[model samples]
Target: MASSYVEELLRQLAEERERADRERERANREREHADRAERKLAEEREHAEQKLAEEREHAEQMLAEERERANRAEAKQAPTTLEQYLRLIQQRLVTTLLVESNPVNSASGSVTAVNEKFYPLELCRWDDFEKQLERTFIEISSVFSSRSLFPSETDILGVQRELSPTSRKDEQDIRPFVRSAIEKPAERIVRAYYDLTNRPEKFCFQNNAYSLEYRDPETEIERRSPSKRRSPERKKSQPIPDRWGICEEEGGLRRVCVGEYKAAHKVPDEEIRQVLDTASKNLFLEVLWRKQSGTTNSEQDKAKELVAQILCQAFHYMIQSGLLFGYITSGRTLILLRVDEFAQQRQARESEAQYAPATQLATFALLALRAREMPRDWIVQAENCGIYQWPLVPNPALHQNISLQPQTYGGETSESSGENDDPNDSDYGASQRQSRSQPDQQSRSQNERRRSPRKRTERSVGEYCTQACLLGLVQKSPLDVSCPNFSMHKRSSARGKHPITKDDLCCLLRKQLDRSLDQSCECLDRKGFFGDVGVLFKVTLTEYGYTFVAKGVQKANERDLAHEMKVYSHLVPLQGKNIPVCLGSIALTRPYPLVSMAKVTKMLLMSWAGTSLCYNTWPEGVDIKKETDKTLQTLAQSGVRHDDIRQSNLVWNAERQRVMAIDLQQATITSVTKRQASPPVLHTRKHRKIARSSSHIKGIVI
Candidate 1:
């Protein structure tokens, strides 16, 4: 209030100013408190958000760990490698070795045929074999294990074991107990053999179980008709082998070895002994001298004839099959026999009945010379070079021309115990000992006989014939100097006119849905590999019984196939050289069902490029890297570029005998158009003047 209340007003104004200051102080305090509260709320929110983020991260990590554990568990359950397979089979073999054991001792039979020496194979140390297996497994498994269509099963061994016979319980039963017990197991072991070493799968067992065209036991009408006129050869039973090894490496399955099985009592130990005794000498003398010897009993003479007839039968099979590797197994006892490589046996189909004996005698003479004259030391050395080993097979020229040596054995052979199933059994082979009987020694009675009239005595597995020494010999494939099957270029030479024309193939594929192309044809089996853009199936056909690999692609990737067919056409000269024979291409009338393929409109038919090439499947003497380089160079010359180059793309064409190039899908072609170049333009005065007019002088035309 105005000045007067001036004295009073001053006092009142001061009081009012004091009140305003107090109110201002109160407002500042409220604002400071609000700022502090807001800061505390924001800090609490950030702390909660950080805690939530940490929890989320921890949950994700737990999920990842769970997935890893599951994968590891799955991997543990299925055995993948051959090494693992070996362990599994080893146990099964041991368990089944003597499941239905029956002992029947055969009476001692006389042997008139001498055992001939063969390429002596050195026994492989089981430990060494394992190490070799490990090396090959590491190198090859990483590449082929995933894409393999090997048809492996966990219970394959179980199925194999069940194939044994349970009917023969008698001690003297003369049934084929071997088929169930030993033969099946033996075949599996041989199948596993390729994996145990670096050897390629050159052989496949052809057992009667698969290939035999069994007919009813001789009918009364057929038996009575033998004497009837006009005996058509078709009525006769085919001479198919009980067990034989066939090489698919040659297009047609060719028998390379034979096996004969008998009861333990059928082939006597003495017969076995005599065969091995003359392994490095003549065999015919066994029969000749024993028959002439007055000391031999009638029973012994009968035994001699029994063994002779059996051998003669086995020999005939070997001759006709065009092979010399023959084995005689009687469940318990195993006799691996190999004949001389150079000897010429007259095939029954090739020779007249009257001339057979003379031809056989000539064959025996050559075998006798090889046994008596081959140097033992040379054979031992050849074993290292993989030359002089059992089944000196395929061609003689492949191994050096060194005349082989035959080693003889001494000492009593220790029979492997029934319980001993060790693979690395290092049973030492017996060394040679002098067997010259003193000419002055007097003959003793049968009760105490030392020198009998017969020249040969009973012997066991000895010298080079020991099982240990035969492993290497069996690995090599021998060849004759004139053999077309062994020639590298034989693929082109051996193939006849294209089995089916492309025009014919198109018509055939049109009928694929009905499962019949040619008459009487049936799809026996099929195995397939599903690829990213295509599919491949190995189709086994009946009637002809030929197996072909059919490669197919959907309409989307048909362009790739078209380009591949064109590439194959350019590579026509290389067929049977560095690639397989492309039988040609076809378009399916219908969409073929493959992995996720609703429309497989393209098909490619080609020969098998053997198996995948790797350190394990590599053919001896072939350097894959060098071969690959050459293959690429050849492709370049043909004006093609293989955009995809890898070891996996190269295959071993076993039948064609070459490292083949495959999977030409990613390839690009440099068109080999032969258009001529235009003639060079000549400089004329008019053209020169025009050029001078167009050209301006830069600065000064020095």
Candidate 2:
């Protein structure tokens, strides 16, 4: 029994040892599974952190790029020097003048004069204001004196001093038909005219418009009559109008201003309006009326007619070519007209009683140069470039330095393209050669044909390469020397399979000009590039003859070229007559090859015409002035405004006696007037919020 019990104990001990082993194995398996899950979770967390870091970096990069773009835009939109100055004056000077001065009531004949008491002048440094005015006048005078401001001294087209008594005159009878009722004579002046003609001699003095000669009706009739042919003896007796009116030289009437002469008493509002209307609008009529005096009429009627005639004649002289100013006066009262069209428009608007009060004292005094005839005080004031001060109310003669050249370019034929072995040939000499070249449309392919790119895309890379080379050429060229004309062919490399590179296109343009790597063309406007847009150069071309080249490889320049081309296309018909004729244009398919640059470039070829007005004199034909005025009127009718209408832009062709316009880059074309005017735009609340947000983003206060 002892042996059996021992055996049973051994078996039980064996079973207990096996159960302990199984439990150890199960715990090891659970621990291994848990360790694997923990490792996987840790790996996932690290991956998620890396992705978040990358996303944050990308967002920051995007924000930086957007900020840079905004900065660039702001730089471009910044105001130019002249524009900034104008804004400053508008904000400060204009506001100050308006505050300190009283409203000029035309009826009361009260005018605001910026004298010693002018608060703005007293508050600020007089020297600074004077300096600004000097600069302003210099610019204005340079522009004005440069071009043909009036008909040449030799122009003889004359309006009859007296119209036929029996003729029924109407608006159509006016030389330049009054555009609107706004340009009518004042009723007060017209009524006053029914009562008086003081002696024109009273108003006539040296350098005054009143000194203009009066054409006698009887004499004019007698001379013009078919039966009144004059022999040598009779011819000597018949009066001939002086070539330069009453003045001995070219500029007899240097400046023209208007004035209303009242009897120093307070005029009625109706009379004042009538006077202004007459002075502004109807004064020109007196030029047409043949009768200045009535011999059979009573003294009152005779006086009335004479006064009207003399005033009209004086006004006519003031509006003549080379007019420095326009003004209206009534005894001590004075009002000056603004120079530019925009300023003039505003002045006109304010003149009407219906508009705002005459608070524009600064505009008249500083801008229009209006003041009392305090000659002694004026002398004291005009010391340092003071004679060239604001309004520069010019006297009859400033200077006689005529800069107009006789030839466009010297002695070279268009066939030669103004190219010569002589290095002394100037830009003017080349342009003279251009005057004889073929008319517009000489290059049909250049103007009309479009070339397909070797590799098709939005734009071709080959063209871009070509433009880059051209710009490089312009930068290195001179404007005063003549360039050789050479032929350029699209020749391939020895391999005959290589694509055209930037170097190749440049070489092609160089060859066309016969210009080697060391040689360059001449710049016309100036010797170097003034800005990023482009440089103006005198180029002799084999295909287009002598041409003025404007090349712009920068994006801004490209935009300017595009705008000019658009304007050129519109005025193509008037080319060589009143505008620069666009000969052709060139563009590279891609942006110029410059560092950090990815924009297209373009070049324009225009007919080499006359120099700017500064270098030329006014044509001596009244017809030309009339034509120019007509052109302005036509432009206005078309809803187009020549915003940059100034002397520099007016190019005068002495040979053809033509006045052509250049630089229409700042022109604007307005939308046509609606037959049924559209209701004013009203923004919804959501739109207003969006607008406010956009303005804020643009750094503009709405």
Candidate 3:
């Protein structure tokens, strides 16, 4: 206020200035307070956010624990079937032997797994089993020599370990060495039987030869491993089998019998009806007996009786070993047992008219016994055969060593001998002398010339017509020379007695209306990677497409296929998730039977996993690294380690929004802990999707 009116104005001006200063100070304090409030709000927000994050983490952990508990409960509640039990036992054995010991459960787990496979241990009663058992014992004895019949050598020479006798009952866990030893001899005998029967192809044994043993009787029972001291007794002894056979397909030699050998013994019953009832036990039992001079009939009868008892014991072995078609013998009596219903029916038919037990038992001991009786036509031929007689004469054309033409049952000699020793010449000498006097020889020669057929200079259309007929083409012209229907004519002339070759069979197929009767059809297309493992083909099916990987007679490929099949089969529990579904396998033979085909190709049919996933094309919202880690974790849980986890081997399913692992042919089954060694992300490329931070930032800037 302009000097607040002079004097009063001077005081007013000072007050005004002081008021301005106070206002400025008040504004400053208010601004400071506002800044403090904003800082406090930001700090509170950060603390609240951190607390929320921790809660989220804690909740996630709880959910995971709950899921784990549920899974454990479900597993415990699930009904353990015979097949599942068998698979469990197999998995345990394979895991223990082939994988590391840390991740796997203790030895007690193996005992428990085996116990589950045969919980009841009761034999399924079959009327045919007895006859089949007896026959198998006889057949095995006949095939295996007296020297190879017994296992005394193996039992005495095998590895031995010391165990505490007092703790035997409490020892639920079986040492790898101990379990292997217990099963060795029985397996060797079984293998020998399969080898002799020429049926090793039908069975697959474990890759490792089992070395079972007994407790060292020499070791003191009271001696125990000293605490804090390494004992020499802790060393494991490995005893080699007297004879061990290895599976060329799989490189292991464990005691467990698998594949067709296992399949043959898995019988279907009320309790176990899931598996196919194809049990045709190939049981083998041999009883060694030395040759005795003039053995009495009574002694022979006793021997027969002993064989019968041995037959029962052999049957027990068959049940235990899980085999169906086998042989049983007691040095003298050999019987072949085919446990299928057809064999049983045949045996019944053969024995229906015969009433002697001695005769019945004797019949059971015959080798190469047909499942069906001999054809009636053949029986008639055998009954009506007659001997023919020929006159004997000396011949000039015969060698000096050769004597007069022997009296024969109409058997012929050499053409030169016949020409020189012509019977007609000797008989017709008088007639010839008379004809030569009358010039009738010239007339006869002219008549012979007229009767002789003219020779053909070239092949006619008739020969070509056969090929046309093979193609199922009808002859267009009736006047054309009609060749004999080779298929029909051969069948009629042979009367179903002669065996038809594969070529003949193919030719005969043309007569049928249906062109595709074979189980495996011709490959319509072949494409993809052909490597040491197999040749992969792209196949088009009626409903969907598939990858047809053909392993053509390559042992390594076969092994890989075997490994794949094993892995695939074991991962049945993981279908429709991380692994491509294996449709099945087709064994394509080269227009011949498996035994006769020189080269056969095995084609694995798997569901077409659309397109391979790469770093560049990882699906939207899908974390490739996280998903891969989860997949690897699942595989590890199954004791599998996918060694070949490459982009090419991973397929993307757009609909499922998942990645599937393909080409498990090169995969390995290993311990869970061991699996950790294999990286979850196998290969990294320089693709933009997974570029480094610097590159990404630069790219963004650009």
Candidate 4:
């Protein structure tokens, strides 16, 4: 029995060993299969990466080749004609600036975020815009000898492609790219107009984007009405527009036209379309979304907010800047806009005129399109089907620009504008002078005729929607007038016609004591300028047709006005020629429109001094620096040593055709001094230094 047990035990052990061997063999086979799968995956991943890299390289190479081809073609063609060159430039810009081959339709989707200030604007579309200014723009450009209007293709491509891959993906900093792409093209093209039409006035472009465009507009209306209240928070460091159409004038580099640009991604084609009235046949139109229905359609509200966001900024900017032609664009669509001064004024008088009665601080913000304290929906058209025509595009004929003097990039030469005038233009220029003879008649006719009712429409951008339209505005140059509207010679030549004595001035306030001040005088500018202690207004006395800038201050700030008065009194001899002629101050019987804060009771009238000097270069035969220096030197000799000497102080007096130092409110009287209209030079046997200086001598005893 013991022997049998041992044999069984050995057999059991043998069986156990065999079972272990079989398990080991199975585990080894499984390991081998797993390793094989792992190797295959690694090999496949490596192969895929290599293929992707190759594809990327090929795409880059092909793009480079295409760019080379485009460059070669541009150079080889050398399109000499202005139209041809412009077309080529437009094509290249289209290729560069417009990146969306097929933008997403956003009209039905999420709205873009922007600070919204809802305002009503009467938009007028220029139906025959092609005929408004010297027929077709092509013809206007044709008059210019085609010099190199286009930047070199290589340079253009390089600037256009400056966008980094990260920036393209991020899309936050797209304005620079858009500006770089179009600024040079539009500017170079416009140069021909100035060179050909206003010869000796060099055409240039200024990036006033970073410049101080205007002071913070008084936004009291926002506080008064909850419906019109919008967050006034905005970028404080920069100006509104991205680009400026500047030309060298005697006063400074004049801001002719301005443009507001947006990132294509931020302001998509669909959003622009959403704002436009597509039901009509016109190419351009204006939209003002007024009144909010409590019935909220999230989609429509988003659109309304978006449209207001995009337009309110630029609309207010153009209004304040006083420009004949201005535009807003996102690479996909361009909308040309013109401000009808009379129409805009009428609208204000009829609609938002209540705030300007001057019951508070001179907080005059441009609430032009906005409705405060009113039942909503005044700007929007309810088609009776609960369908809202949100953005109204105005189709008004592009009228000739009047006069505006914009502050230059340096803030040294900031020329304010007259109603419907260009910033660089003074109302006393060629246009103003020609119309001066019949000033009352012309103004009356304009004031009587309201803006055409044909202005607003629910229309598609149509033909003007193309990027080519961006280039088309290049021809809307205000080249018909002299480069510097009221420079030295022009002012001196027209001196006889202007008011000499205070009584000679055509003052509406004095003539119409029975009527309200607002009714009697025409407000050339609502928010013209903010002085140290007083607000400056461009006004036309309606009764006798006296146009002068009124320096107004509230009753509280009369002390500062006294100091300014003293300075003017000291420099009395330099009045009307070297300095602005002071028309005596008047206490207001009633509040004025747009500028009456706590009833601006005192107004010191003075001839319009052209804006400050900013440009190093002036129009041919003009030396602004020399002229201004002489004026300052003369001021120093006249007991009044103008302590403040800067470009801003040196005002270019267009009426007198001289650059005189202004803003003497901060000036000091250094000593008791005396001067003469024409000091009798003592001509002795030996010629005195003063006698030898050939010219009509007008200064202190030398």
lDDT of 2 by residue, 87-199 (tens): 33223222221111122521332222111110100000011222333344344334333332222111211211132222212212221211001111121111112223221
Worst 10 residues of 3 by lDDT: 424-433
How well is each residue in 267-299 modelled by candidate 4, as lDDT tens digits? Answer: 555544433332111111211212222333455
Better of 3 and 4 by TM-score: 4
Could you tell me which 10 consecutive residues in candidate 2 have the lowest summed lDDT?
Answer: 425-434
Error of 4 at 623 (Å): 20
lDDT of candidate 4 vs native?
A: 0.41
Tens-place lDDT digits, model 1, residues 1-702: 565678897888999999989988888888888888888888888888988898898899898889888876655455444334334433443224332333443333432222331222211111222232234334434433443222233454554456453423322332234443344433443334334444333334446311212222242234436675434653644344456643332111223456665554555445444334323222223333344444445654455445444444444444333243455554444434343321111122221211211111122221221121111122222222332211123243432332222223232222322133222111111111111221111112322221221111121111111111111111121222232222321232224222333344434544652342222221111111334344554443222122345566666566556777777666655654565545556666444432111235666765555555532476688777787788788878877787866655676655455566777766777866342222111100000101111122111100
lDDT of 2: 0.31
- State each model's CA lDDT, in order: 0.39, 0.31, 0.32, 0.41
Which wins on lDDT, candidate 2 or candidate 4?
4
The lowest-lDDT stretch of 10 consecutive residues in candidate 4 is: 357-366
Show where candidate 1 strays beyond 4 Å: 1-80, 94-157, 164-202, 207-240, 268-284, 292-294, 297-312, 341-408, 411-702
Native-to-model Cα distance after best TM-score fit, residue 23 in candidate 3, in Å = 99
Which candidate wins on TM-score?
4
Flag the better candidate by TM-score, 1 or 4. 4
